[model samples]
Target: MLTLRSFEQRDWPSVWSILEPAFRAGETYAFPPQISEAEAHEAWVEVPAATFVACAPGGAVLGTYFLKPNQPGLGSHVCNCGYVVAPEAQGKGVAYAMCEHSQREAVGRGFRAMQFNLVVSTNERAVRLWKKLGFTVVGTLPRAFRHARLGFVDAFVMYKELIA
Candidate 1:
């Protein structure tokens, strides 16, 4: 079974292990592939309103996610989130659970909506999963992401209203 909880300082190493490959791949997120551990820590943990980890029964972190306001002050009602699952944990519903958990957490925090600023169009699995979870593509930025392997690719700005 998998469990979710607020991230602890001890979780950083495991979280980094999951995030490093994805960020290094440069296929989805826009972060520089060469981003250092301190930079990633600040972005993933320090900057977010909250961060969480998905763990296995043995306490192994299977995935991680962060939640933050998509914008400041006037636009703060809408939140933003990012998720990363260990490569070994992919296709096992970790991302799905994290996304669902994020929505509930967002609503609890009084966010009226949730937005994903940059969903790489080429990441078909994530695009399909987000759609399955009721997020819609609000807009698309053509060639917005310069994928390390695929060159430039379109990116989607996905959003879902948390309130009725």
Candidate 2:
């Protein structure tokens, strides 16, 4: 039984554990492969306006996500989000659930839209899932991400209107 909920400070360790691998992989997020744990922690939990975690029945975090204003002042109506799941939790609907929850959460946070600034093109699964969840590729940056082994790769800027 997995449940989604607002993140707590106590959840940082588990959330960091999930993010660290993804950030270091250089296969998904644009974060530097050698990003330090402290840096990843600050970037994921502190920089974002809100953080959330999906937890197992016993309260162990299985995945995490963060929501933040896409820009400052005039552009703040659009929000951005990033997600990562524990490797063990893959294929368990964690990402789908997180994305669904994010849509509602974004609207509640006063954001009219949600955008993903960089969806790595090499990450086909993620790109496909984002599309399935109503996001559209509004733009593409050629060779935007330097994948760990694939050299330079394209990235998609995915967006969805969360409010009508």
Candidate 3:
């Protein structure tokens, strides 16, 4: 079983361990591959409205995610989130669980919708999973992401309304 909770200062190291490789891979997130720990902490923790961690039974972190407004002012009703799961925990349901948890948290925080601005097209698993979770591809940006290994690739703008 897994548990999700607010991020604590002590969770930074484990969160960074999970985030470092994925950010370095440059395959999914748009962050610079050589981002410094301080820069990453500022982006992942300081900037977001809230951050959370997913932990195993023994309290070992399995993943982390952040939630923030997709835009400011009138657009703040829509939120954005980024997720990263430990490599060892991949193929499990960590991402799915975190996503579901995020939606509930978003609604509670007064966000009416959620938007993923740059879902790299090459990330088929994430695309499929988001679709399964009821998000729609509202638009596609042609050659939007310069994937680490695939050069330039398209990206999708995925969105889902949390309330009618």
Candidate 4:
């Protein structure tokens, strides 16, 4: 079982443990592979309107995510989000739960749509998962992502309209 809650200062250690590997590997997010703790906090906590942690019944964090407007001012109705699941907890539906929760939360927060501007093409798991959740690759940006191991790689601009 899992519960979602607002991110707290105490949650950083758990969240960092989940994020560090991904950040160091440079396989997923666009952030620099060597990003510092302070930089990570600025991106994960400070920039987003809300950051959430997914925890087990015992309160151990399984994963975390952040939600924010995809753009500024007039474009603010579109929400954007990023997610990371602990390596040990992968394939157990953490990302799925986070995605579902984000949609409902975004709607409640008055977002009309959700957009993922840079879904790495090689992250087949995430691409498939997001598609399963109703997002479509509205556009592809060729060589937009400088994957650490693969050098420049293609990325997708995925979107899902939540409101009519």
Per the 3 Å backbone cut-off, how many clashing residue pairs does candidate 4 have?
0
Q: Can you give the lDDT of residue 154 in candidate 3? A: 99
Residue 82 error for model 4, in Å?
0.3
TM-score of each: 0.99, 0.97, 0.99, 0.98
Candidate 3 versus the native: TM-score?
0.99
Lowest lDDT 10-mer window, candidate 3?
A: 83-92
RMSD of every prediction: 0.5, 0.9, 0.5, 0.7
TM-score of 2: 0.97
Off by over 4 Å in 3: none
The residue-by-residue lDDT of candidate 3 on 18-124, one tens digit each, is: 99999999999999999999999999999999999999999999999999999999999999999999999987999999999999999999999999999999999
- Candidate 3 C-alpha error for residue 94, in Å: 0.4
> lDDT per prediction?
0.97, 0.92, 0.97, 0.95
Error in Å for residue 96 of model 2: 0.5
Per-residue lDDT of model 1, residues 13-63, tens digit only: 999999999999999899999999999999999999999999999999999
The count of backbone overlaps in candidate 1 is: 0
lDDT of 2 by residue, 1-164 (tens): 78999999889889888888888888998888889888887888889999999999998899999999999999999999999999999889999999999989999889999999999998998999999999999999999999998999999999999888
